[model samples]
Target: MKTPAIAGLILASFALFSPACSQAGINLENTRVVLAAPSKEASLVIKNSATEDLMFQAWIESADKSEDVPFAITPVLKRLAGEQQQVLRILYSGKGLPTDKESLYWLNVREVPQKSREENTLQIAVQQRLKLFYRPAGLPGKVTEAPQQLKWRLLAKDGKPYLEVTNPSAFHLSFAAITLRMGSKGFTAPIDMVAPAATTQVEMAELPNGVQANSLKVELEVIGDFGGILKYDGAISG
Candidate 1:
């Protein structure tokens, strides 16, 4: 089982590792990348904070493993000196992608450190992945409002409790954590994402003993525009 901290680090676009971890030498200026409508491309900035020169390779792939994504990254491979920064441009081909809703992709940045021949020493390569959101023209609601537009409900299936969440808006709702409160008892669901105009169910576990699922209040901490987590509160529908 994965801990909440580890799961958050994986789903979150922001860098969660501390600077004391020398392996985490590359710093990203922005945690989330947004390509708005009427813009052909978006840019991301990466910096090398370590004293040694670092080699980096960046690429883009569909986060949901969809086929034929229409995005490309420039300067696929490069070397950055200490305290130096480089810009990565993501150009959209405007093909094989939807124009009615926001699309999601993952921007992977792999760091290769120069190998040392010293005995009894270890070197580790670091790979960072961030979210890339492609926004089309004229969506129903703003991306920032996605969390508030989610529909939540609690149901029992196969003798177990499950939380049903539906996203009615045109923006993807990526949640960092979800807390469901019923009277004096509360439980947190794992991190997950609900696609635009889609619904997903999460199995509830570790719930308080003898707690009822009906009339539960829901609180969600969702990923924001700048990679920070924002809170939203709502009640579960019957």
Candidate 2:
């Protein structure tokens, strides 16, 4: 156990520069993938921007690795010449996913290690894992409108303030940032994501002073299709 664990740490320490994973030479065309239902298939382009050839592999896995995943990717292993790109076809089974709300998975792409003959050689193979959302057909509101449907409220406990976010829409709501605003002053914090039909309390994003008596205006930076950030406004809920 100790030998393997210690060797893992040493290998990770040398991964200071990301070349094959998500950095300069190799890259994914998009940051996130949205698999809309009724299509059952999606694709991603892996590009080798460096001048040297590289090998890549891709796969889809559950966010929780222990769980069984229902996704498969074609061309799982491929070698791309310099300045070339390859497409990875992602196909989802028709069943085994939530129909009422979006489900989360991870698309993992990694650089395959190459055999090199050199003295004391160490190779860094980094894997890029991105958020993949699978949306079944005929859910609640449109994803564009889901951001506006979020409800928010402020609660003070232990002399600090916390914001409770309730997502009413069936689509999973991803918030990049939250802003608590008084009339003149505002503070912002990063709230990564919130699930559909669920409530989440964001901490460390401190509320503005005088939140107890006043209904603070809340602003959210929501992630939209194409991984773009969009702003939406809502008020404190009761």
Candidate 3:
């Protein structure tokens, strides 16, 4: 992945991470920072899901898009918690990007310390999901058509059977019901939507009973708001 000169500059100023929970309560929910932008730089808005006072640390981590890449975590944000919503921002510097008029980056957020049992579960689940927001670090005023599909293939450590999928649209796709089917077995996509113009390869090793195969048939069926459906299918050999 050779990053363009612009990407080089974008990578330098970029700081990507997930959001923190804002309130302090038994069901303290996470405060999320959503991404949006016109330039190569990306920004997120962190919102609290709880109704009470709260505080916690925050930080970022690189998602395991592939088994070949080692896990990398960003620096931690200390004493960052509140009841109201907050904003966390990141800028991208020069970085390698695909020359095919496409670019990608990983964005994640880890909780400082879940305040309660419920909060702990939320944080843990988010961590396990390995949430990453993909971005298209294109140059200014460049327009590209959104992809009609998103695809992925997963391989087990034993190299027996794995999973593969192709999403039919570039719009935000829900991962809640997205599952990996192997004969009678099934596993869900760890997180939600694969950012537009990006291909997300979710690591299945961390999923329940997910690492015991070499190769297998994989498919993804996603539901849309208009009662429409998106599906992807393919075979992967471990």
Top candidate on TM-score is 1
Clashing pairs in 2: none
lDDT of each: 0.76, 0.74, 0.40
By the TM-score metric, which is better: model 1 or model 2?
1
lDDT of 3 at 7: 13
**Candidate 1's error at 126, in angstroms?**
0.4
Compose the digit string of candidate 2's lDDT tens values, residues 1-238: 0001111122322334543332336799888898998999988888998777888877777765645778888887798898999988888988898899999888878776565444344666667777889998999669999887887777776767777888888887776887877777777755788877888886544555445635578788887767789998887754
Candidate 3: tens digits of C-alpha lDDT, residues 1-238: 1111111111011224433333322222222221233343444445545554444333343343332211122223433344465554554443443323322334444333344433212232122112333334342332222222345556554543334444444344554356666668776556465544455555565344544334345565554433345565645543
Regions of candidate 3 where Cα sits further than 4 Å from its true position: 1-38, 49-53, 65-82, 99-106, 114-130, 137-238
Candidates sorted by TM-score, best first? 1, 2, 3
- Candidate 1 per-residue lDDT, tens place, 1-238, comes to 1111121122122234432233557888888899987797999999998887888878887865655668878888899998899999999987767888889988888776565544333455677778899988888777787787788877777777777888899888777888998777668887578888898887787764344646578988888878898998977875
Residue 57 in model 3: lDDT? 33
TM-score of each: 0.85, 0.83, 0.38
lDDT at residue 19 of model 3 (Cα atoms): 33
Clash pairs for candidate 1: none
lDDT of 3 at 88: 48
* Highest-scoring model, lDDT: 1
Weakest lDDT window of 10 consecutive positions for candidate 1: 1-10
